[model samples]
Target: MVSSDDTYLSMRGGVSRGIRRMGGEEIYKESQDCRILNALSIGDVVVTSAGNLPANKIFHGTVIDWQLELFPSKKIIQKVVHDCLIKANHYGYKTIVFPLLGTGAGCLNKQIAWEIMLKQIIMDLSTIHQTLIEVVITLYGRETLSDLNWKFFINEMQAKWEIK
Candidate 1:
């Protein structure tokens, strides 16, 4: 199933938005031949050797770069998310997983990031092969989940898709 990682949240008093750390293990690339590869980027393509992974193709999507804004403008985030979906569709991927964009050192507010993400997903749903493609958001920390705004954003997003 598509899911996010559990994160440890540090809270002080009643306020949110504090330090966060790893709370779960990552899924190793599976050992099965991939049916397709989709690179979602407007820049150079990159490839790395994974000695034992089963997937034959690896897609390098330059969704974010350090030269770019750490907390990119909302429009850019939306564009990149849309681009990822389009590229996946272009390559006929039926299932895809994405980490929360711009939440790392990028330091964008989680609520804003999620809002843009959901908007892009909703826009793409009616256009792509909706039944075949699945989008998964991987959360890397539990502490990050304390944002009530983000929780509300997720609820609204799920409401739009009836996809709880």
Candidate 2:
């Protein structure tokens, strides 16, 4: 079983490269199948109905807002991460995978983002047992991997899990 860590980050290659570079203003068309909505402050969970995806539920956490341009602030990101954990905690989800929040089109600093993410996750896990749930942060493509040093994340994970 994949062990629980304060942060779980990985690097992998992407199947297809995006046409445009990340961090510019790009419009995301909302389909009838997929809708975006405002997130309530309570538990930092954004409630969205069933989307085209197979998952019974899709939680939309706003990492970036055009009008507000909140773009994965450390506080906002932490709240979002916390909400996911709370959902998993209450719903009994054993494992949930997450993507790098601010790397794609969010214009965030990679090293800083990793540090902030790990800090919040460690804080969240302090209240819960490790056996209950595990989260994996998935990285897709060389661009992401290049910016985010995989070794840093791995080291953070080791420290959090008490691995020698």
Candidate 3:
């Protein structure tokens, strides 16, 4: 997912901190039973019940192997996102939220990661005629938003998608 360690959903660090904050400590404890590590590998994904979080499920995706590279290949990122979306659709999820994949501890270039993520999402949405109702790409923290050039990203998306 967000370059997590063997701890399934540890309450200590990274994206898990946000997840733990929202879902509570009990959820993290519960998640340990899920064997999240076993499901993780580059390009692999696992879906778990979100417990107290305001979503039906949390899709954990591994877009990069941290031991190998800080920034993964664009093709790998696209495939991971595509597979996650496909799994969400299969699970009958109408709405899903995605973080900029590999932009966290993976140390990916934020702007490039955003661009790749947006491009892949746009392509997927165009190709897949399925149950997906909404796809929300969320950026946490002011720093992350700034680093990602949020305004430019929005403007570019508007231009590309012909949003009026």
Task: Give all TM-scores, in the order shown.
Answer: 0.54, 0.59, 0.74
Angstrom error of the Cα, residue 159, model 2: value is 7.0
Writing each residue's lDDT as its tens digit, candidate 2 over 21-130 gives: 12111211221123334323322443332333333333444465555434567786777777777766675667755555565656667677666776777778887654
Ten consecutive residues with minimal summed lDDT in candidate 1?
5-14
Which lDDT tens digits does candidate 1 get at residues 1-164? 21111111111111111211111111122111111243223222222222333422233223334433233457656665665566556666676565565555456677777777777787788775654357766566674556537667768768877995
How do all the candidates rank in terms of TM-score, highest first?
3, 2, 1
Q: How much is the lDDT of residue 109 in candidate 2?
A: 74
Task: Compute the lDDT of residue 164 as modeled in candidate 1.
Answer: 52
Each prediction's RMSD over C-alphas, in Å, is: 10.2, 8.9, 3.8
Give, for candidate 2, the lowest lDDT window spanning 10 residues: 1-10
Over 1-164, each residue of candidate 3 has an lDDT whose tens digit, in order, gives: 22222223343555656886777665565566565347455666656667687777766666555455534568767877888779888987788788776666667676887788888888888899758888877775665566667688789888987989
The lDDT leader among the candidates is 3
Q: Alpha carbon lDDT of residue 81, candidate 3?
A: 82
Q: Which runs in model 2 stand beyond 4 Å of their true positions?
A: 1-44, 49-56, 129-131, 143-147, 150-164
After best superposition, candidate 2 residue 144: deviation in angstroms? Answer: 6.4
